[model samples]
Target: MDKSDITLERLRSFVRVAERGSLSAVARELGVGQSTITRHLRELETALGVPLLNRTTRRVSMTDEGARYYANCLQILRLVEQAGDEARATRGAPAGTIRISCTAAIGVLHVTRLIFAFQDRHPDIGIDLSLTDERVDLVREGVDVALRLGPLTDSSMKLRNLGHSRRLLVAAPDYLAAHGRPAAPQDLSGHEGIRMTNVAGSDTLVLQGPDGARHTVPFGGRFRVDHGLAAREALAAGRGIGSAHRWLVDDLLSAGRLEVILPDYVPLSVPLNMLIVPQRTGIARVRLLVDFLAERIRAIPGIEQTR
Candidate 1:
C-alpha cells in the first residue's frame, strides 16, 4: 500500500466513522454530506487495499483489519493534535477551527451572538457551529466542545458548570388581561398553554413555592412548537401562557412585554454546562473557548443575578 494516497482528511473520516458507526451522523457533525464521508472511507480502504468496515443497512462496524488500523490511526491523530497544541502553546495563542453543537433555540437567542463576539476578538480562530435539538456524540462528530444542559443521566463528557438556568411562567399582557391573571398555580390549567416540543409528553409542571411547598400543574393546549424561542415568541404574541427560561425572557420581562404568571413559584432550573472530552481539554482553543463561555454566559440575565 502506498502511504501517499492516504490524506489526513480521509484518515479523519475513517476514524470518526469507525467510532460513530454512522456516516450520516458524522456528515452532519462535519458539515458535509454522507456521500463525501462514504467516499473518504472508500478511498482510504482502496489505498490501503483492505476492507475496513463491515457494513449493513442498519449498522457499521470495523473489520478485524480495521480494528488494528484504528488503534494506529488514533495514535497518529493524537500525535497530530499534540503537535498543534504544542505549537499554539509555544506561541501563547489559541488558534484553530472549533466545532460547536448546541440546541437551535439557545443558539439563536444567546449562544450565536456570543460566538460572533468571541470570533471578533480572536479572528484567527474559526467557529463551526451546528444548531440542532437532537443529541449528538461529540467525539464521533469531531466537536471540540458543546454547550448543553446538565446533569445528563448518560454521558461521559467532562462538565463545567456554567451556572443554572431558571424557568418562569410568562404570558403577554393581552393574554393575561383577556384570560385573567392566574390566581394560583392550579389556575394555569384553565388557560391556554404554548407547549414546546422539547418538553412535550409531560402535562405536569412541578414547581416549588416560596415557602417550600410543591405544586404540580397539569398543562396542555392547542399551541405547540419544537423550539423554545418559538414558544417564547408565541407567548409574547399573546398566544398563551407558557414556561420560559429567565435568560431567554429577561429582557422581555424587564420591558414589560411579558409578565410573570406565578411570582412565588419557581420551576426546576437546569444546569447550563460546557461539555468536552476529558482527553481533549488540554487543547488551547478548547480551553480558551470554555473560559470565554463561562465568563459571558454568567453575564446573561438570570444566570448570576438574584431574583
Candidate 2:
C-alpha cells in the first residue's frame, strides 16, 4: 500500500495504542474489539513499511521509528483539527468535545460550575472534565486544556495566566484557642502541621510571618493526606494547622470554622494558569476551552480579589 493510502483512522488507532500502551485499553476506549485495533496497527505498519511498535506479552512500547512517526502524526492530526476549527469558526458557534484536566480544588470550587454555565451558553460544545491533583501530560493524557495553579515548569506548553491565589495558613478556631496562634513562621514548628502529598510524593506549604518574610515550610506529619478536601476537613476538625488555597477555605473562614494564622505572613502569591499543548492550541475545541477557562477564571470573585 502507498504511504498516502494510510487512512486517518489507522493513524488515530496507532496513536491511541501507543499513548495508552495497550491495544486492549484502546479497544475499550474506541468500543471495539482488541483484534480490530491490532489489525489497524498492522495495516498502518505495512503501509509505512516500518515497525512502529514493539509488542510483547508483558507490555507494548514504541520503537524509534514509531516514535518519529507518532510525532509527525500528531502534527498532522493537529493541522487537520485546525482546518476543521477554521471551518467551524465561520459558523459562529463552537462545537465538539473539549477535554480538560485540573486540580481537585479548582475543579470542585470553580471548573464544575463554570463548565455547566459554559455548556448552557454554548450548548453545541461537549465537555470532558478530568479532576486530579496530579500533574498531567497534556499530549499523553489527551487533554485539550489544563487548569494549573502555582509555577509552571513545562516549557513546551503554552501558559496563560488566569490569576493569583493566596496560600494561607489556617487552623480551626477551637484548635487555635487551645494551642494559641502562631505569631511567626517559626512558631509552626511547635504546632501540629498537616501535610498534603501530591502524586509524586512531594509536600508543599508556604508561610508568611510577622516580619513579612515568606518561608516555604516542608514538613513531615503524623498524617499525610493526598486530597485537598481531606486536608481541609482535618484542619476544620482541629487536626492541625494546614496550608490551603484561600478560595478553598473561604466558606470555612466566614463560618469561623477556620482562622488564618500569622495574617501578616502570607506565602508568595501563586498564579493560576491555563495551559494548552503547543501542537493542539490551534484546534477549535482546544482554543474554545482555553478561552472559556481564561474568561471564567478571571471573573471568579475569590481569585480576582486576591492581591
Worst 10 residues of 1 by lDDT: 298-307
- What do the candidate models score in CA lDDT, each in turn? 0.83, 0.80
lDDT of 2: 0.80
User: Could you give me the TM-score of model 1 versus the true structure?
Assistant: 0.87
Q: For residues 1-307, what per-residue lDDT tens digits would candidate 1 score against the true structure?
A: 8788798899888899998998897898678999999999988999999999999999899999999999898778777887888887777666888889987777788899999999888788899998887778777667778888636653688887777888898999999889899888988888898886676454678889999989888987898888777887898899998888887888889999999988899877877777887657877777788889888888776674323
Check candidate 1 and list the clashing pairs: none
Candidate 1 to native Cα RMSD, angstroms: 3.1
Tens-digit lDDT track for model 2 on 106-133? 6898689989988898898898889987
Clash counts for the predictions, in order: 0, 2
Model 1 lDDT, full chain set: 0.83
